[model samples]
Target: MTISSAHPETEPKWWKEATVYQIYPASFKDSNNDGWGDMKGIASKLEYIKDLGADAIWISPFYDSPQDDMGYDIANYEKVWPTYGTNEDCFALIDKTHKLGMKFITDLVINHCSSEHEWFKESRSSKTNPKRDWFFWRAPKGYDADGAPIPPNNWRSYFGGSAWTFDETTNEFYLRLFCSTQPDLNWENEDCRKAIYESAVGYWLDHGVDGFRIDVGSLYSKVVGLPDAPVIDKNTKWQASDAFTMNGPRIHEFHQEMNKFMRDRVKDGREIMTVGEMQHASDETKKLYTSASRHELSELFNFSHTDVELPSSAKTWSHLN
Candidate 1:
């Protein structure tokens, strides 16, 4: 896809001309006719995708999960979901994809992990646990007249409820911007971030993964103080949270750290692509996110144009007139 430049000093990157086809493993192609697609099933259709003019395949989350939030809530980043096949099948698919001259990319759902995840399990087990700080657990704002505890804030989850979910064992609440089953990871903890990198990013990159489509990258770093969002709709206590969540202060810094790690892992000049998925970011923010000089990301998925269908007020994502 590269064109003739007036200056002859142009070097083209693989992704610049790559046509990536996204695959949802659940229904993409079925090999065993089990009514569900597996990693091998996707591997079987590589030639078809390549012939259709695709240079790369970006597969959605097939990580071990509890099938909550359509597998966006990952329980184990290192293991392939049993429904989608085993780890061997995933590795074989990666190898086959590379052999077919097509790059393989996988969705990185690092914004949150399944509540069933061991990290989350340990985090919620006790307030004194070493991993307790790995997640955003907050004390109740206060107790009501009846002595029932109130949530830390009025922030709304994207799935239409309070973002904070209470735990009976810990007597505290944990933040989940999306489904309650997906507890948001606290990237503020350097140890937590390192563990995530080892188990998720480093593990995959060490394998043959060519890139990652980072889910909800803009919401990675929330406002430090965890302030309540401004109220929008009068009828609902839950408030829109774009002001505190979207484009957090250290987003670029975090991305740069990831980019640096990716670069450091490079062997023989291989370029690993990274595209952040953020629907609410402005064009200016996206520019910085993808700027080569910034060393942030290879690209960014933004919905500045397609957001017209959304309401002007800071509401959770939904189709609206």
Candidate 2:
């Protein structure tokens, strides 16, 4: 494992000791009496963040989204939602954060884009469209041994039901790891990967934000074969098939490229701090992410503790031990 060597001259002392305050923008506070939190609301709370001993703030997604998934479905990458405020409002918030000696980080949802996004719209139109391959689309299996339209696999979505959504216009099933509207991008396509890496990360880096909190960061890549998953448990009538595609084959390679892109674009050699939201990562996965030389992720948000019922199972305790 190769750990990234910190350049003593360029590293920021604050990063090593930084305490981050995560602000769920919609619920944090409302400023304009609109009953929804916006940039102005965050700006109003800068002193509060500083008073809490945090050195930086990580704001949830505030981009133009349908709000179907509570802002997880981003409609535009470059512009801030009008309900949140203008781009200028974001700049103001950043300025206020820096004035209090706190760095600012924003959420980046790259694994999938809102179904309303232009790329997805185009991709869903026709198979021959230029952007059709931008997302994962597979022909529906017309017949199995029993003769029925078999889904691409036995994968279920995190929300519910099948992960493969049949598009009537194109007669193809597009893979949606999350909600039906959030189509998963095909990271295997170099153009698709490069476009996302540059547009999402590069645009923000150029905008002077300190860093990013990557959402669903591990689901960027899918197993190339797109094979059906084995049904291990039969107790539940409905089950989510996330295990089959969550941390797909090329996740590490994709992250390495993203890391290199980030490092190469740093203005003064300050390492870009990134925290990945890893939902079901095991101890081994955690180590891979945080290992010094992995080039995968700097830090990971593992929800293992949150999911476990404490003091009940010695086996769980043993797993941790």
Clashes of each: 0, 3
Model 2 stretches astray by more than 4 angstroms:
1-13, 143-150, 235-243, 309-321
Local lDDT at 51 for model 1: 95
Candidate 2 is scored at a TM of 0.87
Which candidate ranks first by TM-score, i.e. highest?
Answer: 1
- Model 1 bad stretches (over 4 Å): 1-11, 318-321
Candidate 2 residue lDDT tens string, 166-254: 88888888988778888898888898888888888888788778888888887787777777766644543334555556676778788
> In model 2, how large is the Cα lDDT of residue 164?
80
lDDT for residue 196 in candidate 1, whole number 0-100: 83
State how far residue 96 of model 1 sits from its true place (Å). Answer: 0.8
Model 1 agreement with the true structure over 1-321: per-residue lDDT tens digits: 232445666446788678899999999999898899998899889999999989899999999999878889899999999989999999999999988888999888888999999999999989899999999999999999999989999998888879999899889999999888999999999999888888889899988899998888888888998998987877789987878888998888889998898888767577898987877776788889988889988887666676566776543452111
Looking at model 1, which ten-residue stretch has the lowest summed lDDT?
312-321
